[model samples]
Target: MKSFYIKIKSFFHSIEDNIAFYPALLSFLGFNFAMLMLYLEDKGISAFVIEHAPPLVINNADTAKTLLSFLTGGIISIMVFSFSMVMVLLNQASSNFSPRVLPGLISKRNHQYVLGMYLATILYNTFTLVGINPKETDKYQLPGFSVLIGIALTVLCFFSFLYFIHSISKSIQVNSILEGIYSKAKTRMIRLIEKEKKESPSFPDTSDWKEYGSKETGYLQTFAAANLINICKENDLQLKIIPIPGAFVLKEIPIIKASKAIDKELVEEILSNFNFAQGEIVDDNYALAFKQITEIGIKAMSPGINDPGTAINTIDYLTELFAIRLQKNDDTIITNEDKSLIYINTINFSELMYQVMVSYRTYCKHDMTCVQKLFIMIKYLLLQQTNNDHYHNSLISEAKYLYDDATANVENEEDKRRIEQLYKSLPNKRE
Candidate 1:
């Protein structure tokens, strides 16, 4: 309830949020105008006189008193009527479903339009109360009084027309504006892919690459291989592993075939000593394969921030890859050094990825929209991931570092107290 009140207050404080204010003001204006018209009619000067002001002053004492009463009463009644209408609109419009009509009215640039309509309403109602019907005026009504009522009604209708227009304007789709933001995000993704490509090595079309086998000949594999080749070329590194026919063997395998043909004695000796099977091929590009696999897997995981389901699906995909690699007999040969760099582009990254699943879960469990929570969580996770790349190997270590940095910034008493409280709230640190 307190949070709700706070939001309501903040909304009213901003001019942009005036959608809830204008309709209310309009109703108030309308009622006030009606009362003013009533007062004008009660005065010695008929609605006709007020409608058509005489050039010469011919006011009697009684006429002056009557006019004064009419003016006072009409103004008071209009105020009351306006207030009543404002209350009605406020009660009718639910914030969750309908746009606040009152605020929208206040947002308009034309105050004169608002004033004129309400003023006319008051004049018309005042004239009517005084028995001056414009349509029936020809029978017995004074000209000015009857015409004033007609004028008031016209003003009321004009205000209504403007309100209708404003309603339509407010209802216009805002999706294009949202789409513009998404466009920037798409561009950023494309740029990142391009940058990584530029920085990475390309795969060589050697016989060794063929050893990863044709099963690797997919769009994702091609892109990953290209990235690896680009990285190698940029770094001036030797082809870490040469491509060969039929399935890539791990880089640690000592019996790789040379890029060019070598002496049979040396090839046979090396292959025989390293436990090579007669049919086994040497030029396996395990480095390229691993790097490519990890990169593609990360790309698939990137969309999980806004969508929990996407994150879960991505995690599942990476989990399969990790499991496959673990199951392979040669996988045990992947050194700690090689595994560290590869995981960033693969399954390990998902453990620290944004808790999109948690956000959706919270939303379902609680009545909250969770949009803001999801946004903050995603932003924090991205920052943490980037920082982890900067200073640490594991997610847990990076998270601890972040907590330490945050703790070090405490200066004031309030901040120190908050820090202490936060420290207490933290989970036990993993050794």
Candidate 2:
């Protein structure tokens, strides 16, 4: 039952991440509201309201029909224009930023809500217009209140459209994107730190464990750690997960090791707790935020784009994220109430630093400004470092690599000398 609940939770999380979820939900609400209005009109509720309504309120079917018709056309145009702009923005983001960021942009709640509002207004107006009886003389069935509501919704949507434009403009800005990624990464790191600080039982030894291979191949989006821990506790098994979330695993590759051999059925059942998808989602896996930020920096420094300013801004945000990561623990362990059940592997600080810095060095090595920025970033990180000699050494190694790249690629003697000076000033340079 716990496993089933976890599956349900994961399913909802996936839906929440989908771009169309909110819009579809709002569209359904609009359709149902239109149906309810029609029912009210048939029951003479609209007729009674029309009789008592003020002169400004649309009481005649012909006027309401014309108004709804106009609104429908106007909203349809707005939807088309908004969708076109969204497509253009997406294209710009993909070319100038990173394609990985497209999901974050697409799943933006404000944009989705605005689009959904437009859809709701259109659907409501269309359905309300159909329910109007222009030729009925005995009892006019004009949905005046419904028409008024539609008009109000249209005005609301108009304002929402304006806000959407402003929001999209800001969303596509490079600095905004980098800050968003950094903020999310920092939040994830904080959560990890809090989790690590919690008291938990030590993991049992599993040196003689039997390894279980996964049946699928893709990015390990997420797994039910709590459920897995409970399962291990119930089965009297000690498990070690070999791959972290955001890792790519291959079919028949060992993903988990157990204290004892398990049957194929149990193996498949255990694998069911893991979710693998074709692409990475930053919300589920924080490490993907680092990857996305790195890609954005790379794209900014590319020959075709040649926007070193944006790359430098990205470095600033990454430097902040690395500072937060520096103070966090590297291990991931989960246990049951009183006993250790699972141990999972996660990317250590040094590896994450290497991955991000290497990508920056590979792309921005020729740009002296970026090279200098890298040295400064490393210097700031060095100050944030604890007594972890290994981490400090890693920072020093990264600095040397940045210096070497700048030496080989930077042509101007003055710029090279500046980078050399920056490298020389780094802590532990002699080591």
| TM-score of each model, paired residue for residue | 0.24, 0.92
Candidate 1 local lDDT, residue 330 = 20
Residue 296 alpha-carbon offset, candidate 2, angstroms: 1.4
Give the Å shift of residue 247 in candidate 2: 2.5
Q: Please report the TM-score between candidate 2 and the true structure.
A: 0.92
Q: List runs of model 2 lying over 4 Å from the truth.
A: 1-3, 51-57, 138-140, 200-207, 411-413
| Clash count for each candidate, listed in order shown | 47, 0
Per-residue lDDT of 16 in model 2: 69
Please give, for residues 265-349, the per-residue lDDT of candidate 2 as tens digits: 7788788888887777777777888889889989988889888988888888888888877777676677666566778778887
The deviation in Å at residue 14 for candidate 1 is 18
Error of 2 at 336 (Å): 2.7
RMSD (Cα, Å) of model 1: 26.2
- Model 1 — TM-score against the truth? 0.24
Tens-digit lDDT track of model 1 for 40-121 = 5456445345346653232233343354346435544554554465455444432211232233233433433444454545
Model 1 misplaced stretches (Cα beyond 4 Å) = 1-35, 46-130, 133-153, 172-431
lDDT, candidates in the order shown: 0.35, 0.83
